[model samples]
Structures are given as structure tokens and as C-alpha cells.
Target: MTRSARRTRRTTRSLQVAGVSAAALLALSACSSSDDASSDSSSTPKSSSSPKLTGTVTVFAAASLKESFTSLGKEFEQAHPGTKVTFNFGGSDTLAASITGGAPADVFAAASPKTMAIVTDKKDAATTPATFVRNQLEIATLPGNPDKVSSLKDLTTSDLKVVLCDKTVPCGAAAQKALDASHLKLTPVSYEQDVKSALTKVELNEADAAVVYKTDVKAAGDKVEGVEFPESADAINDYPIALLKDAPNAEAATAFIALVQSPEGQKVLTAAGFLKPTA
Candidate 1:
């Protein structure tokens, strides 16, 4: 218990307390750093999922597919919130003309295989085409069988006053094929640019009977009556879809294509009276 020894012991005790305090501060600092790292990692979104695509997708679909394609477009937008679908639904031939003339489009859905070939031949498609659906000619009459049109041969009965899609149109081509198969010649009073316009003519009571797609007649539902003819089997035109070569929103376009081919899409298409390619 000498004064020098007492002073030395006090200084040693102070050094020990300081060391403990420093160690405790270091432990707290380490814990804070670990929490910060964990917070950062948790805040970050996962990267191993499908990328979110935000852009506009323009589709040039066949005129006959208007109803079904429109339904599919709405479903697509619902599934992908940050996407917009702009559709240019028209005659496949007209669509081909527009696209070949340099119109911008994300995807092309042609009613005819020939028109799709025109697109692919020009290298306008980014991928191989996929046949999505098929359609054939149906006799669309104005509110019941006003013409009592039962068969293809019946169309040429002189008083039927039928309107038909132009030879350039898929429906018209199918009608021609059907007529050719039956060895019957139909001299329609007028040739329409598309099945829709032809159906519209019948719906408006302008034409007695017009040939259009089964899907188109289904969409008309009560506006016109569709009569299935046996000749339809001879001229089924397949619908093909593909991404455009100069697509701006390719990811969305591709997703839209897959969605149309998906079960949900097939259901929509089928419900709208579109026959599946396989079916």
C-alpha cells in the first residue's frame, strides 16, 4: 500500500476500462454494418426473373380476327401493365400492302398463308411463322335465311344477289376454291375488300348473302346468320403470326405472341369462334 503502487494500480484499472469500452463500441459498429448490408440486399429487387418490358406494340392483324384479337389485346395489357397494344386490323392483303410499303409494326397476323409468305419472303419477319388459327367461308345472310341459301351451288341461282370478298382476300379466295371444287361458278354482284366489309354489307341489308369467316359471323351474332356449307371444308385458310423484322418492342411482341398461343389465349380465340390450327 505504498503511494507509487496505489497510483500504478489506479492507472492500470483506467486502461482496462478504456479497452472494454473500445471493444464494446467496435462490436456495435460491426452489428450496425451487418444490418445496413442486409437492408440493402432486401431492398434490391430480384434479377433472376422475366424482365419488365415497357413499350408500345403495334399489331397488324387480319380483319377477320378483329374481335378475337381485340380481346386478346386487352388480356395482354392486363397481364402486362406497362404495355400498350395498337392494332391495325384490316384485310390481310391491305395489311400486306401497308407493311410492304414501309408501315411500322411489331407483329403481323395474316389470314392467308400466301400473304404471310409475302412478308417472310421480304425478310420482314424476325422469326418463323406460326399458324394460329383457320377460317373458312360461311354464307352470311340478313337476319335468317332470307335467301334460303343452303349450298354453294345455291348462290348462283341468279336471284340470290350475293356479295363476295375480292379474289385477293382470303375469304374470297376460299370461296373461289370452294366453288372450283364443286365445279360451280359464283358471279357475285360485288367483291368486297375484306370479310368484315362483306359481312357489314349483309348486316346493313345491302347484300342478300355474302361469304365471310365463321368467326366473323360469330362476332356479328344476331346481326347476321351464318350457314355452314360443306364446300367450306375445301378452302380452309390458315392464319399465321410472326414478329416483324423492324419491331421496336420485340420483347412485348414476343410475349404477346406466346400469350395468344397459350391456353388462355386459345380459349379466347375459340370462344370467339376461331378454329385452332390443330383443331
Candidate 2:
């Protein structure tokens, strides 16, 4: 052959080798970039599922929840350092109205689902309310079982001077249901605005008897006597709780709610004579 032909063949071979090296380098660079991207993605922190709670939480609860919820409130504050809890306890219906009226509260706990419905209907609740406890009606009497009040029908006695919660309140509603279930009608001496008021009438001997919650009677201690009637079973009030839609301290409110449904909270409520929510 010829020397020029040999040289041309050598040059082509060298070009081929250079092209292969360049392709290999490109592939290695791409692989390294992909690895670096994956590593960066893995190193990124993920968002937490639960928000960190701080600050104050205002809770609006039923009148009957005064004793139990107050205890739980203290516990919640202890569990969460740098947190404060304030409460407004009143008739369930009244509290519901206050919340719907734009009361700046973080949480709401009602004695009856019907009352809680008022808040839910107005979209004042942040989430679906949950029943945390059950309450039953009882005849609260001036200490020592005076007037011989035995059953729900006994409240109908004309001479007893009985006081009842207005039908608008949960306690009154439950009491009316129990009386209706027993086929009895009673005309109370007065209709109070809340359970505490009705219970107070009996405590002060202003009325011979009042249809109030068992918890109220228990909390009253020696001041009033409690009588349980079978008809109360037909009118059990399911207590529900929820965080408000425009809660000032949303995270703290949520944590407070969880604490109420926790075992420790159940213990405190049961001790105050509230029934456990049925399965």
C-alpha cells in the first residue's frame, strides 16, 4: 500500500478513540448529576403532621362541665408549658348562641348534640364535633330527700314547688324527655336559664326539687340530694366538643380537645358523675 494511506487510517482510529472517551465522560457526568439531585431531595425536611401548640385557649363549655372541665383545664395547662386556659361555662344553648354571634373562643363543649348542631349549622366549628361524654337527668332535692320525691312522676306533685331549666337548655330538654317518656306532665314553679340556676334553687331551699344533671347534684355535695329515675335512660344527653372555625389559638385548642378525650380526662369527668360515651 502507500504511506499516506497508512497515516490516514491511523488518524481515523485516533478520532474513534476520542469520540468513545467523550461519550463515556458524558454518561458519567449525567449519572453524577442524577445522584446529587436524589441526595438533595432526600435531605429536605418533611412537614410535620401536627402543628406545635402554644399560647392561650379559650373554652366555652356547658354549665354542668364546670367542675370537670375546670380540672381538665388545669391539667392541660400543666401538660403544655407556656399555655393558658380560660373558660366560659353556661347553658349549652346560650353558649352556642354566643359562639355563632362571633364570640372569640378557641373551643366549645356542649352538653347536648342538639346545641352543638347550632354551632355546626353556622359553620362556626372547625371540624365535625365529637361526643366526649354522656349526661343523664336527676331530681335534685333540698338535702335529705324531703317531700318524698321518688320517681319522675313525683315532680308533678302540686305542693313540691319544683324548679326546672328552661326547655332551651340541654338539662331542661333531657328532663322534659324523661317526663314525657313516663307519660307525666309537670308545671314547675319557675323555669331557670341554666342547670346551675335550677340546681341553685334547690341548694338554697328556694325550691323543694329541680330536675338537674346528676353531675350537678354530685358537685353540690351535701347541699342537695340526688335521685335517679329509670326514665332518664331514655333521655341521655351526649356531650360534644369542637374547635371554633376562627379559633385564636387553633393548635392549642386542638390539643386541649385531645386532652379531654384522653383516658385521664375521662377519669376526671367520671369522677364528677358524668357517664362514659357509649360505643
Candidates in order have lDDT scores of: 0.89, 0.92
In candidate 1, list every pair of residues with a backbone clash.
none
Which residue segments of model 1 deviate by more than 4 Å? 1-47
RMSD of 1: 4.9
Model 1 CA lDDT for position 255? 97
Clash number for each model: 0, 0
Tens digits of per-residue lDDT, candidate 1, 1-279, equal 999999999999999999999999999999999999999999999879888877899999999888888988998898899999999988898998888789999999999999888888888899999998887678888897876788778889988789999999888888999989999988888999988888888888888889888988889989988888998988999999999999999999999999999999989988988888975
TM per candidate: 0.83, 0.82
Q: Report the Cα lDDT for residue 152, model 2.
A: 84
Q: What is the lDDT of residue 91 in candidate 2?
A: 91
Flag regions of model 2 displaced more than 4 Å. Answer: 1-52
